[model samples]
Target chain A: MTMPSVSDSGLATDAAEGSVVLERVTRAFQGRRVLNEISLHIAAGEFVALLGMSGSGKSTLLRALAGLDEEVEGEGLIRVPTARSVLFQDSRLLPWESVLDNITLGLDGPDPAQAGRQALASVGLAGRESAWPGQLSGGEQQRVALARSLVRRPQLLLADEPFGALDALTRLKMHALLRALVGRLRPTVILVTHDVDEALALASRVLVLGNGRIADDFRLDLDHPRHSDDPRLVGYRQRLLITLGVTESA
Target chain B: MSAEGSTLGGRITSSTPRTAQASSRPGGTRLVPRRLTPLGRLLGPLVLLALWELAAQTGLLSPKLLAAPSTALITGYDMLANGTLLPHWLASAWRAWWGLGIGVAAAVLLALASGLTRIGEASIDSLVQIKRAIPTLALIPLAILWLGIGETMKIALIAGSVFVPVYINTHAAIKGIDIRHVELARTLGLGKAVFIRRIVLPGALPGFFTGLRLSVTSCWASLVVLEQINTTQGIGYLMNRARDYGQTEIIVVGLVIYMVLGLASDAAVRAIERSTLRYRKVIGS
Candidate 1:
C-alpha cells in the first residue's frame, strides 16, 4: 500500500512537544481492517475535527491516538502526548460520586480539590461541587465531563462526539464554551464527530475518513465565529458534505 | 349524551383556571393520596383482631383449637413476668444473630471471590448452585449426624441457609456492574484497590442489600426450624413444649414473637437501604 503523508502547512517549531505523528498505523478487528496503513501529522495546539460515516474508522483512529486501543490488533506507531484525556459521547461521570469528586477522580497533586474547583468554575459550574452526577442536566453533565478532561492539563484532548447527546440549543452553547476553553487551554485536540458544521465551526483542520483511510483532508483556514451562512464556510460545507456522500438540492 | 359530552368538554377546556384556583388555595391538597400512613397500615390487622375477639366471645371460635387474642396476650404477659420468655427469647435471638453474622460474612467473602476473579467463579459458582438445589431443612438429619444436634448444628444449618441468597444476589450485582465504568476506571488509571473501592463496591451495594433483606428473613425461618430439633432454650423449644402440654395460648405467644421479630428485622434492613441509597430516584418515595 502506498502511504500518503498528511502534514500541517505551518507551525512546526514546537512539533516535538504536543504534536501527533502517525506512521502507517493500521488496525484490524476479526481480520477486517478498520484503519489501513494511514500516516498523518498534527501540529501542536491544532484543533482537528475528524468526520466520517458510522463505520468509517473515526472513533477507531481517535481511540488509537488516545492509547485506548493498546490491545487492538494494529501495526504502526502512534505518537501522542502521555498527558491526554478523552471526552466520550455520554458524560461517563460516576453517579455515586459528587461533581467535584468526579472531576478530581484519579487526579494526584498537592490539592486536587482546588484544581477541580477551578476547572468547574471554568466550565461555568461553580458551587455545584457536592451535587450528584444524576442531579445535573444533560448539558451540565457534559460540562462536568469537560471539566474532568481539562483538569488533567492534557496536551492532547480526544473527544468522541461530546455534544452528540445534547439538545440542539445546548449543543450550540457547548460549542461556544468548548471554543473558548480550547482558545485558553491550547491543547492539540482531535474531535471525532459526524456533524459537518460542528467540525467547521470549532476545528482549524478537518479530515474525512472513508474506506478505512483518510479519504479527504481539508485545512480550514477560515477564521473563528465562522457561521454556516458565511460564503467561505458554505463553500467548504458543500464540498465536505459532498465528500461525506450528502447532496443538498438547495 | 351529546349534551353531557359538551359539558365534559367544557370542563376540560376550563381545567387551566381550575388548576390555577387549586394552586392559589392555601396548603393545596395532593392530587394523589399517600400510599399508606402508619395508622392506615395497622387498620387491617386491628379489624381482623376485633373480628377474632368477637367470634371467640360469641363461642363461634373454639378455644381448644386456638387461643383467643386476649388469652394469648395474658399468657405472653405471664411468661414475661415469670422470666421464662426472656431466657427463651434471648437464646433464640443469640442463635439468630450468630447464624446471620457468620452466614453474611461468608457470603460476602465468597461473593467477592466469585465476582472479582474468573478462577473463583469457575471453582465456586457451580458448587454454590448445587447446594442451592438442596434445602437447608433437608440437611438437618445429616447436620445432626455431623455436629451432634448441638447449638453448633443449629447455627450451622441457619448459616448454611442464610448464605445462599446473599451470595447469589451479591455475586449477580458484582457481575452486573457496567462495563463502561470499568473502562472509565482503566482510562482514569485507577489502581486495582481504588477501582474495587470506588466502582466495584458501590456498584454491588444495591445487590448486597437485596441479598441481605432475603437473608434476614431466611435467618428467622431457619432458626424457627433449628430450634425445634433437640433443643430446650429457644422459642421453638417453648412452642414444642406447649404443643406437648396442649397450651394453645403459649404456642400463640411464640408464633407472635417470631412474626414481630421477622417484621422488625426486615424494617431495619429497609431503613438502612433507604438511607444508603438515597441517591436513587425511587418510585413511591
Candidate 2:
C-alpha cells in the first residue's frame, strides 16, 4: 500500500452559510429511544457521510436535517437559514409522471418550464424529458432523484442512502455525479450510507454512528472528486472495514 | 455519462427509445407501428352485433321483440335523416349535460373542503356514505313531489344518477397523493395559489378524470330512465314510443345510437386526458 497526499486543511468554510449543528438531538419512537443525545457539526459546503448498520439512526439524523422528522430535538443553532432538499432511499418518482416532471416536482417560479429543462440537461437527461418514470431503469430513476435534489440547488442537501438500491457500478457513477455536482454547486451535503468505500471516495469527513451516537469521526482531508483508487482511500477503506468487522470490499 | 450507451460508471442500460422500424414484405412501407389499440377496441362491439344479427335472422328472436342489427342500423339513420329522432336525443343531451356539470362542480367544492379540514371531512363522510348507499331510483317519488313532473324533476333525476361516482373519485384522488409531495411544495415557499394550481390539481387529475369518465357514461345511460317517467324527447322516450307501437326496428335503432354515442363520448374524454397529460409531461423542453 502507498501513502497518498493530504492537502492543507483549507475547509470550504465560507461557501456554506450555516454549518449543521446537532446538539444532543434525541429521537424516540413510542417508548424506544432510537437516537439518544447525538450531537455533531458538519461544516459548510463539506461532504460528510454517516456510516452505520441498518436500523441505526444514520437515516434518522439525515431526515432530521431535511426537517422530515421534526420530532427530533436539541439540534442547536443551524446557520445559513438556507434551503434544503432530501434524496430518499427509494427514488419515489411519481409513477404517472415523466422523468422531467419528477425532477421539477417541488421547484416553483414564474418559469418552471425552463428550470426543469436546464436541470434535466445538467443530470444528462436532456432527451428524456417525456420518458415516463416506469420507462426508466433503476439507475436512471435514481439519477432523476439526484436531479430532483439538485434542482433545488439547496444550501443543505440531506440524503438517506440515496444510492443504497443501485448496483455497485451505477452507485459509483452516481457518487461521481454527486461529487461533481457538490463541487460545482457547493451545497453542504450530509450523506447517510452503510457503504464504507463510498464514504472514503466521496465525503471529506466520515462519521460512524453506533449505539445511537457518534462512535467515530475521521476527516479524510481529501480533494473534491477523489478517485476510488486513491491510496489514502485504500487506507481509509481498510480502517473502516476493521471498524465494521468485515474484510469484503463491497 | 454519454447519452449513447454507457451510464453510471460504465453500467450499460437500455434507454427507452420511442422509434419506428420498417419491415420487409410485399409493398412494405416503413413499419411505423399503427395505433392498433383503437381498432382492437371495436372487436367486442362488432362481435356482439354479429351475434345479435344472427339471432334475429335465424328467427331465434322475434322481430317484434328484437330487431336485426342490419335493419336497426338502417332504420336508425332513416329516423335521424328525417329528424324524427333528433328532438328526443337533443332533450336527453341537454338534461344530462347540465345535470352533470352542476353535480361535478358541487362535488368538487365539497371534496376540496372536506379534504382540507378534519371537521369537514368527519361531518361529511357519514352523510355522503348514507346518501351514496340510498338508491337514486327510490328518490323519484320525492323528486316528483318536490320539483313536480317537469324539467326540474328530470334534472334532479339526472343529478342523482351521476353525483356519487364523481364525488367519490375526486375525494379518493385527493387522499391517495403521497404526503411527501405536499411537504415538498411547502418547503419551496410557494404560496397557496401555486400549490393548489400546480401540485394539488395535477396530483388529483388522474382520479378526477376517472370519475368524470364513468359519470359521463352513466349520465348518458341514466337519462333514459329519467325520460321514461316524465318529460318527452330523449332516447328513452323514443324507446318507449317504439315499444308501444311494436316498432322494434326503431327501438333497436335508438338503443344502438345511444350505445354508439356513449362510446364516442368516452373515447373523446379519454383522448383528452391522454393528450393533456402527455403535453404536461413533454420531455426535452
Candidate maximizing lDDT: 1
Which residue pairs in candidate 2 have backbone atoms (N, alpha carbon, C) closer than 3 angstroms, thus clashing?
A: A18-A79, A18-A80, A129-B283, A130-B283, B22-B31, B88-B233, B88-B234
Minimum summed lDDT over a 10-residue window in model 2 chain B is located at B12-21
**Model 2 stretches with alpha carbons more than 4 Å out:** A1-16, A71-80, A93-119, A126-137, A224-232, A245-250, B1-60, B186-191, B279-285
**Each predicted complex: what DockQ?**
0.47, 0.08
Off by over 4 Å in 1: A1-16, A69-73, B1-38, B42-44
List TM-scores for all candidates, in order.
Answer: 0.88, 0.80
- Candidate 1 per-residue lDDT, tens place, B1-285, comes to 999999999988988676555445567567987698879989999999999988988999888778899999999999899998999999999998899999999999999999999999999999999999999999999999999988999889889999999999999999999987887787677898999998899899999999999888778777667888777898988988888888889889998998999889989999999888876878875
Per-structure clash totals for the candidates = 0, 7
lDDT tens readout by residue for model 2, B146-183: 99988888877678668888778888888877787666
Best by TM-score: 1
Candidate 2 to truth, TM: 0.80
Over the stretch A1-250, how does candidate 2's per-residue lDDT look in tens digits?
A: 1211111211122324747776656665654556776667777787898898777788776755655554433333233335777787888776666778777765767877688888778778889998888778898888888888788778888888899899989898888888878889998888899988888888888988877777778999877657778888888887777766677756
Every model: Cα RMSD to truth = 5.9, 12.6
